[model samples]
Target: MPIYEAIYRSNDHEELITVNSIEQHEKFVDVKNHLYCTYQGCTARLSYVPKGKVRAHFKTWPKNNHIQDCTDYFERMVTANKQKSIATSTMALSDKHIKSVLDNLKRKRKEQESGTDKVKTNRKKKPRPKVNPDSFENTTLNIVPTTGPEADLTSGENNIKEPSVRNRSLINLSDDDLNWTRSVECYIQNVETDDNRAVLELRDGNYTFRVFFEEFFFDNAPINFRGYFEDLKYLVQRHKEYLFSGVGLIEKRNEQYCMLVNRGNDFRIDDQYIAIFLQNASA
Candidate 1:
C-alpha cells in the first residue's frame, strides 16, 4: 500500500500527518522520533527524508521493516512464486495456451474490422472435456480469450475475479501479491533498446514499471520474435493505444518494479500473441 499518511505519537497524544502536510511548511518538520507506520498492526518506525530530485516521502528506519502483510516487507519474488506454483499447480505460460488466446483475439479483431459476425460452421462440435477444479492446465485450456476492448483494462482497484492465474496492476501490487506468477498489465511509455537487451518503461497511473528482455531471452525466442524490440518501437511510432501484459514475477530492481520476460510464451500485447501480431504487422 502507498502510505500517504503516518501516525505520530508523543508522550500521551497521537496524531496523523501526511507527507504533503509536512511539505507545506517552509522548514522540514522533524517527526522521526514520533512517526509510526500507518499500516495497522505495524509498529515499525518511519523517518521523513527529502530527496534532491524526487518528492519527499516516508521510509522505514531499517528499510522494509514492516508487518508481514505490508507492501514494504522484503521477500524474494522467485522463491515466493515457486511455493505458490506448487500449491496452485500453476506453471509457466504454455505455448498451447498462448496460441489459443491469441487466435481467439485475432478472430475477434477480424470480425470487428469486417463489421460482421462469426459465420456458423457446419461441422459438429466435439465432446466437451471434464475439467478438474484443482488442475490449472485443465481449467485454463478452455479459457475464453478476452479481446482488447473487452478485457478489463482498468487499474486494479475493483475486486476483480481472482482467477487461478491472477492479473495484477503495478499500482496496487503488494509484497504478498507478488508471491505468485501474475499477468501484469502496464502501458509502454518508452523503450530503450541496445544489442544486448531492451527495457520498456511502462506506466499505470502515476507509477512506473519496467519490462526487460535480455540477449539470452531474444536468442532463445522463436524466429519471428528475434527482433521483438524493433517491433515494439514500431508500435510506439504508430501511437497505438495498447496494453502490455506479461506473465512473470514482479521483482524490485533499483527501487523500480520490473518484469523479466524469461520466455516467449509469457508475453502478450493487447491480449494477442506478441510474436504473431508483430510478424503480421511487419508483413
Candidate 2:
C-alpha cells in the first residue's frame, strides 16, 4: 500500500489542492498497466481505479468546473487498447484452426505408418491419366489466397491471374479423383506462416490469377454462406460457360472447370442455383 500524491483542482477555482492517499490512488487505476501523470496546470493524482468507478466519479464532478485532463487521456488509451485486444482475439481463432489441421495430419501420417489401410475399401486406386498431356494445365489447386474478413490476414481480390512469378509449388492429383461422382478430394491452399496468400498463374502461361478459394475447400468446410452465395454461384457459372462454349473453345482456352455443389450440405444459398444456370446456359 504505497501512498499517492495528487494535485487536484478545487471546485471554487483553477488552483490545485493536494490529496495524499493510498486507497484512492489504488482505486483510480484500472488497466493491467496503469500509467499516470497530471494535467499541464492542474495537478491530479490518479490511482488504480476501475473505469466504471471513474465514470461514476465524473458524474459527481461538475462538468463546468475545472477538471483534470488526465481523465480524457485515460479514456483514449483505454479505447485504443480495447480495439487491439479485439483484433488479437479474432486472429487467435485462425491459429487454433491451423493447429488442429496440422495435428490431424500428423495423426494421419502416424496411422498410415502403422500399416493401416489408408484408402477406403469402396474406393479403387487408379493411375494418373494424361488429362492434359502438357501437365501444366492439370492442377486444380494452383495458388492459395486470402478470403473473408481479416480472420487470418486479408481477403483476396477477384482476379484470375497472379501478378509476378515467384517461387511456386504445385501438386497434381489423379484425374480419376475429379471424375468420381461419389467422393471429392479437397485441397486447402494455405498461406505461409508469414501471413501472405500465394498468387496463381492462369493456364495462358503468361497471365495469372489469385485463387482466394476453390470449390473443394468451400464444399468441404462448414462455412457461413449467407454472403458468399453470390460469389460462389458466379464462380461456378463462369467455368461451366467455358466448358460448353462454341465446341469446347472455352475449355481449351481456360481449362475445364466442372463444379458440383452438394445440395444436402448447402447452408446458405440454394445449391441448385449454379446447376440451373449451367444447364440453361449450356443449351
Candidate 3:
C-alpha cells in the first residue's frame, strides 16, 4: 500500500496538510474527502491510514491505476519517509546533548559571576591599530618574497616573477601566464559543488575571483572528490568572513580572472591573518 504523511487539498485553497496539522482522526477523515494526490494528473484517493503497527499516515487507495503511474508513488514516499525519520532522530539526539552542555555552562557562569566581586589588577586591554579603508583601495598583492634556490627555481622557465611594485593582485591576474603559481589571501564567500566540479568564489576587500576544480578520473571511473570538497566547504561555512591562504594557478576567462587549486597546491585556513584583516576592515 502507498502511504504518505501529507496530502494536498485543492478545494481549501490548495494547501498541503500533513499528519502533524490535525489532532484527531475524525478531523483527518473530514479533510481526506477534499484531499488529492499532489502529483499532477494523479486521481488516486488519498486515504487516512490510522490503523496497525506502522505509524499512522495518509495512503493511496489500493489497486489505483493513477497511483501506479504517479511520480509520488509508494517507493519514493517510503524513501523520503525513511530519510525524514533519520534526520528527526539525529536532531533529537543533538538537542538533548546540547541542552545538557548548555545547562552545565550556565551553572558554571552563575557560580563565577557570584564569586567574582574582586577585580583582577593584572587584567589589561591591548590597543588595536586603526585601519584605513584607503589603504586597501587600489592595493595590489606583490609576488610573495622568496629567497635562495627557491627564488631561482621559481624564476626563469618556472614563470615566477619577483615581488614588484608593478604586479597586480590575484583578482587582477592576466591570461598571459596559464601555469603561473601565486600565493593569495582571500575570504571564501561561497562554495558550490556538483558531481564533477567544485567552484569557490573568493573575495579580498572589493576584489573577487573564482577557483574551479574539475573531477579527475582513475581506472575509467570518476574518483570521489567530495571529501576534499567537504573539508573546504566546512571551513568556509564556519568562517564565512575569515581569510584563507593558498597557492593556485592563475587563469583568465572572458576578461575575468580566476585561480585553480589542485591536489599539488597548498591551501590553509589563516586564522591569525583573518583576525587582523577583520580588525582592519572594521577599523
Candidate 4:
C-alpha cells in the first residue's frame, strides 16, 4: 500500500503536507469498506474521518460518482495484476508509443551489440566505462561521437550485410549474466516515469521485468535487431494467449500499450508508476 499523508488543496492540486518534502504518511489501518477518492477526475481527497461514514461523504459529490466507484475497483485491479506482474518497475505510456520505441531500440541495439555485421576492424579501443550498458542514461548516445573508432566502427556504414548476421545476441544483456537478472526475477518498488502524465497499474509482485526503450531502439540495427523486434512484436501480440501455452510473456495490455507501459518502468517520471498514471502536469 502507498504511504499516505495529509494533503491540502493547492492551486487545484493535491499537495502533500510535508515537514521537509520527505512525505511521511500517518499510519492507519486501511479500512476496506470505506469508499476511496475517485482519481479519474478529482485528485483531491475527501474526508471519511469517522471510520465508516463513506456513503455520506460520497454523497458530497454528485456529478462524478463514477470516479469514486472506480477508485477501489481500479485499486483492486492493480493489486490483482501486481500479484502476477512482479514488476520491478511500472510505467504507462500509450500502447502504440511503447511498441514503436521498443521495436526501434531492440532492433538497433541487437544489431550493434551482436556485432554480426562487424568487419572485425583493428580499431583502437576507447576508454570504456566500467558501468553496465543498461546503466547508460538517455544522453549516452550523444557521447558516442567522442568515443573514438569503436563507436565509428560500430556505426551502420560498417555493416557487412551478410545473411548469417541474423544470428547474434543483441544488447549483450550483461545484467542477465551478472546476477541482476536474479534480482530482476524479484519485484522492485514503485517506479516513477520520466514524464508525469500516467500511472503503472500493477507494480512489483509475482514477477518483475524491465527494458530500457532508448537502449532498445537503434537506427543502425540490421539483421539481428530486425529479427528480434519482429519476434518480440509477435510475442507481445500474443502474450496473453502464449502464457497459457507455457511459452511467452506474462504481460497484459494492447500490444503497443504493454510495450509503452513496460518501458515506462524505465522512464524517470515523477519517481513512481502510480503518479505517472494519476497525475498530470507533474514535475
Ranking by TM-score: 1, 3, 4, 2
Worst 10 residues of 4 by lDDT: 240-249
Query: Which 10 consecutive residues of model 2 have the lowest summed lDDT?
Result: 243-252
In terms of TM-score, which candidate is strongest? Answer: 1
Top candidate (lDDT): 1
Candidate 1, position 67, lDDT? 78
Tell me each candidate's RMSD, in Å, in order: 15.7, 26.1, 26.0, 23.9
RMSD of 4: 23.9
Please report, as a residue range, the 10-residue window in candidate 3 with the lowest summed lDDT.
85-94
lDDT of 3 at 34: 62
Candidate 2 lDDT, tens digit per residue, 98-165? 23333443454467579762443224545333333333332232332211233333223233332111
For each candidate, what TM-score against the reference? 0.46, 0.17, 0.32, 0.18
Q: Give me the overall lDDT of model 2.
A: 0.27
In model 4, how large is the Cα lDDT of residue 199?
20
Candidate 2 stretches greater than 4 Å from native:
1-110, 113-115, 118-182, 190-224, 227-253, 256-258, 264-283
lDDT of 3 at 70: 74
Identify the runs in model 3 with alpha carbons over 4 angstroms from their true place: 1-168, 175-179, 216-225, 271-283
Ranking by lDDT: 1, 3, 2, 4
Candidate number with the higher TM-score (2 or 3): 3
